[model samples]
Target: MTATATAAVIAPAPEAAPALRDTRPLRLITCGSVDDGKSTLIGRLLWDTKAVKEDQAAALNRDSGKQNDLGLPDFALLLDGLQAEREQGITIDVAYRYFATDKRSFIVADTPGHEQYTRNMATGASTADLAVLLVDARAGILEQTRRHATIATLMGIKQFVLAINKIDLINYDKARFDELSLEFKEIALSLGVKQVTAIPVSALKGENVVYDGKASMPWYEGPTLVEVLELATVRSAQTVGFRLPVQRVSRPGESFRGYQGTVAGGAVKPGDSVVILPSGMVANVKQIVTFDLVRNAAVAGDAITLVLDRQVDVARGDMIATIDAQPQVGLAFDAQLVALQPGGIEPGKRYWLKSGSRRQRVSVQPSSLLDLKSGKWNRHDGALPMNAIGKVHLSFDEAAIFDAYELNRTTGAFILIDPDTNNTVAGGMISAKRGDLGGLNNEAERVILSLPADLADKILASGILSERRDEIDIRRTNPGRAAELLGELDS
Candidate 1:
């Protein structure tokens, strides 16, 4: 009997799906180990879905020297566009491809799987709503698979589709597929991933991609790759208030002054009360301007110009947000970042942190590095090495404004730019404000606990602590500090 292990994954039957669906294009990424067939899987999707044209198909047939076991031309050639990549038979960079079905449209990023190219994977995963992680059936899972999954999860990709590719190589064995699914579920659970779906596929032969593979494996009954993507939702539902990070101030004439930028979160309308961050100036939306016409209302992802009713000292790098539901304004914040450059992140070094459209000088201090093998964040001091994922404390020269990445990815994610070279060195996600206790007064008391990260995570996850989670603040600390705190409590 096939185990109901993937039930937690929200994959409904096609006939049972909702008629009214979200029309937004679903952004996803295909990632796993090298030779796991990431590019081939995408090419197969394009070929089967009719996204490939006649001329391109002819070129694929003409240039392709190697063919798979099914007597099919190398589908991976479609994505590996560079001449060198074709000769090397390797993916060198992240390739963004667009394809649409009658039901929905998609934007998929096919990321490189090499460990050295992990930074490229981070770039692709940052904006992706879902991750289609591929795995070789014979190989099960590799370290690179864990690396990609960890980075994707950290970058807030909640939905995952584990494509067990090359199932025909293992004789389409149902037992092997089941075993990989179970193993993946365990790893996903450990990484705090709740939504996951596993499918057995053979990209070389195009089984279980866009069409059903009932003839190949009659025992499995599930949706295909296209079906899952059509229904996959973006990760911006849990949003609060309105956010407009001013990219530029437009003043065509002396009479006209408009703040131009994309709406990062929530919605804005005329006469809506908005506050400018870093300066704390209040204003009201007088007119919403666009290139074509004035918009009555603008929601997240909309790019529009805004005219405030009153004169405010607004400039580039300033944030315009709702008054009541404003983002955190502070000088210190905790964040997790992946070092992208070879020089790594040097502690106590000032770098330009760019979030949304705002860029400001900030100093970073590395505190802990995540060990992918152990699945633990170990205490560390000093510079973060290249491609290393580490937790750091950011100190800005002036007030910095941001929401927690979990709450608003647009306002919460940022990149660190090296001051001397002007090159981006790291990508980061803001975890929380340094010393924020929301809506708490002096009369109201709160409990603060310093515990080992593992124990603290367990307690925070427990139902008992979860009910009053707001009343308590638990901070994970190094073992020495945790022990010292325990001793002080006993004394």
Candidate 2:
């Protein structure tokens, strides 16, 4: 008997999976040599992301009387918002744009690419987590490319995207792309940057920018520019212990007193014990207060008003940190800086150093300058010229607080303002604490304070040693050693 064919059933197609999206915004900067199409690339990104409103697009069309052969309006017009920039067809300042996609959102800074505007580029790169370094395929790598990469690396940017723009000019040749990518990879490696993604694209034609260019070049199978950003990690200050630099002491009424500042480094809870720097005053965190709510905890990047269990002498320029993990307090520090202005950073010059919310007078002594082209530090004892990356020693007139830049950037980085001009001259990162004999010698003056451990703790808690904290060194010694040291001092 032939059994009737079993009724066939087909499973309904699974509903299309919802596209995964990253809501957190990625902050990035676009920088390169002059005429590398930085504005065009950013404009292309904004247009492709549909961030441009209809009215803005209409204005772009109106402003740009002529369109390219592809019928796309002058994309640079979208970014060069200044009339001077439009007239000169160049970006003079840092232009910021915000856009989003199904995968992620982005906040991009279109920075000026001129050599003289390196300061502007550095300003943009300061807050960027990733840098999209552009280069014209026809021009290959330029000196400004290296300069920008060096600046970005120095600013703690780890992820880099080398966009080989104007690929259409070279016929989108894979060989050309490979050569440039290999060269740039070596440069990135030299800068201690390992996360580098190189892509071939023509910003003018919108290839491999926000969209895939499979039709133009089928060989490229990797993700587009937007894809790299979606997966990149956001730079977080939570890697270290908590540090809050007091911007101001907020006292609205007799009933309330709060320390207002952004958490520079780790996290703090309501019951955590903290120390006020430069004063060594200890207090327990009573509340984490914000405008909208009284929070239980606060982490890095949180701007909150903190109330302590009792009123201690907390003031602006003072740092409140976890008691067990205090920042380095010293009178001298070694730093790496990029000289910004034409006057250059002169040796033995006193400049105002602003780090976090603290500003202090610092004597800068130039030690060495970095040669961007050769990637070598040249022995230089003279002035650090404009656009020069140099190593210097910073001697503070008073107690200074900082962390190693590698450990916590927010507390370690600073900007130098020229006292004469009152203009910013350099941006620097603290490398390490300098000893008595520069950074070479570890020997330092030791002030042996012979007191009971309990008494010493009380003195520290009393905040009497805060002003002289950096000058005084406390050593935990056995009774025998303490007696010996006391006898030696008496002798």
* Native-referenced Cα lDDT, model 2: 0.87
lDDT of 2 by residue, 294-405 (tens): 9989988899999999979988999999865678777899999999899999999899999989999999998888888898889888999999999998999999999888
Off-target runs (Cα >4 Å) in candidate 2 are 1-19, 440-491
TM accuracy, model 1? 0.84
User: What is the lDDT, from 0 to 100, of the residue 332 in candidate 2?
Assistant: 92
lDDT of 1: 0.87
Residue 90 displacement (Å), model 2: 0.9
For candidate 2, the 10 contiguous residues with the lowest summed lDDT are 8-17
lDDT of 1 at 328: 81
